[model samples]
Target: MQITHLGHSCLLVEVAGRRVLLDPGTFSSFEGVEGLDAVLITHQHFDHLDPDRVPVLLERNPHAVVHADPESVRLLADKDIPARPTVDGEPFSFGDLTVTPVGAQHAVITEYVPRIANVGLVLRAPGEPSLFHPGDALDAEVPAVDLLAVPVSAPWCAVKETVEFVRRIAPTAVVPIHDGLLTDPGRGVYLHHITEFGRDGGVPVRDLRGAGAVTV
Candidate 1:
């Protein structure tokens, strides 16, 4: 399995001849996101949804499928995409992968109602360890994996929270996300904080700089 991090919460996982993109933000349409076989959206948010990009994606890959929670389905249906709604505890297959939906909470907004169908994904890759992407929540019991793409930012995610979260999961390798895409690009410094968080928890952290790509 090969994984490419397209910044923010987006990732491109390629196995066999199929490619699955997870939580693709505007980055997908930017470049390197064409020909996707499937997409797994964690929730409905401007950055995660990127409605402007879907139509182009559909045009490029007519057989591509998009999977999301109910709220996301309703939101996409208005846009005329063939989106499949999913719920927690439900499992589905895409190529050689078996994906399981895990519960999560939406990122807190000051005045907006949180999208309640937020989810984390547990993708079991053929001949490789299962990988987990914790959407907007950090309270989940991390599943075992060869690689764990854990979120390390957002106002609610502090150093202590990351420390505790990593300790609980104890994945072989940990890569940080959801931090570098801040409104103020200077906040990229916060990624440095992840090292201490992992040090305190005794979990090894992988560097997320550049376009993160690794063969698992």
Candidate 2:
């Protein structure tokens, strides 16, 4: 499988002969990104799914089907765009690629803010290692997978929990996500800790911020 980070949480993943794009939000850049077989949005947050930009992307790729969380689907319906609700334990198939959505709740930020639905994804294809992308939550139940996209920095995220999550999951490799809020220097500092954790846990940390299309 091959994955490319287009900034923030957006990932252009190629696996099982299919090209799937995940979370093209406000922080991510997908101006000319095309040939998408499918688009997976974990929630309705603008950072994860841009309200204005996503429709343009779907318009560009008319055949691409969008599978988003239930609320996100409803919001898209208001825009006259059709979308399927991706829920917990539900599996969606994209030819050879099978995506299983898990976890239905986003991480809590504060008591004042309402919690939203966030679905983590597990992608598996024949003879390929399963890839897990936990949208905006860390407490999601994740099974063993070869590659895991771990959120490194966010308002609700802390360095301790970040390292603990990685240490607990202990996936073969990890890719950093949800880091658009930080500057280059700040992002480097966060990645440094996560990288060291991955190294100590015997897991390789793969940061694909500037690097293009990496096979995992």
Candidate 3:
């Protein structure tokens, strides 16, 4: 499988002769992406689901089916974009790829902040390594995967939590996400720590901050 880090949590994943775009939000641009088989969204947050760009995506990839949580589906319906509601543990097929939704809610930001629906996705294709993208949450009990998209920076997460989460998942490799807010120096600091710490645990973490495609 090959994954392109568009920016932040958005990724363009290609596997099993199909292309799937995950979370093409405000932090990333999907201007030229086309011929996608599926689009997976974890939540309704603006950073993960931009109102302006999603419609453009639908227009470009008219055949691509959208999968998201119930709340997101309702909002997409208002824009006349049909979306399937993702149910935890139920696997949905997109050509040769199988996507299973995990987790039920977004990570809590604070006591006063109301939690929203979130779903971490586990994707697998024939003869390809399994990959997991955990949206904005870190509490999901996901199955073991070859590649894990880790949240390196966020309002509800810290460096310590990020390290612990990577340890719990124990993936073969990690691609950092949810780091749009970090400056270059800040990103470098987190990347250095994660890479050094992950190395000790037999996991190689790649910093895809401003790069192109990387095979997994």
What C-alpha lDDT do the candidate models reach, one value each? 0.72, 0.89, 0.88
Candidate 3: tens digits of C-alpha lDDT, residues 14-49: 999999999988999788999999999999998899
Clashes of each: 0, 0, 0
Q: Which stretches of candidate 3 lie over 4 Å from their true place?
A: 199-202
Stretch of 10 with least lDDT, candidate 2? 194-203
- Candidate 2 segments exceeding 4 Å error: 198-202
Write candidate 2's Cα lDDT for 66-142 as tens digits: 99999999999999889999989989899999999999998988889999999989999999878889999888777
Query: Against the hidden reference, what TM-scores do the models get?
Result: 0.85, 0.96, 0.96
Candidate 1 lDDT over residue span 1-216, tens digit each: 777777777877776557888887764433546778888898887667777787776687777799987788888888887788766778898767788887756645444654466887888866775678877777665457766787767665666676667667777777766754565554445555555555454556665445556776
Better of 1 and 3 by lDDT: 3
* Ranking 1 against 2 by lDDT, winner: 2
- Score residue 213 of candidate 1 by CA lDDT: 62
Candidate 1 — what's its lDDT? Answer: 0.72
Question: RMSDs, each prediction?
Answer: 2.8, 1.3, 1.2
Query: What are the clashing pairs of model 2?
Result: none
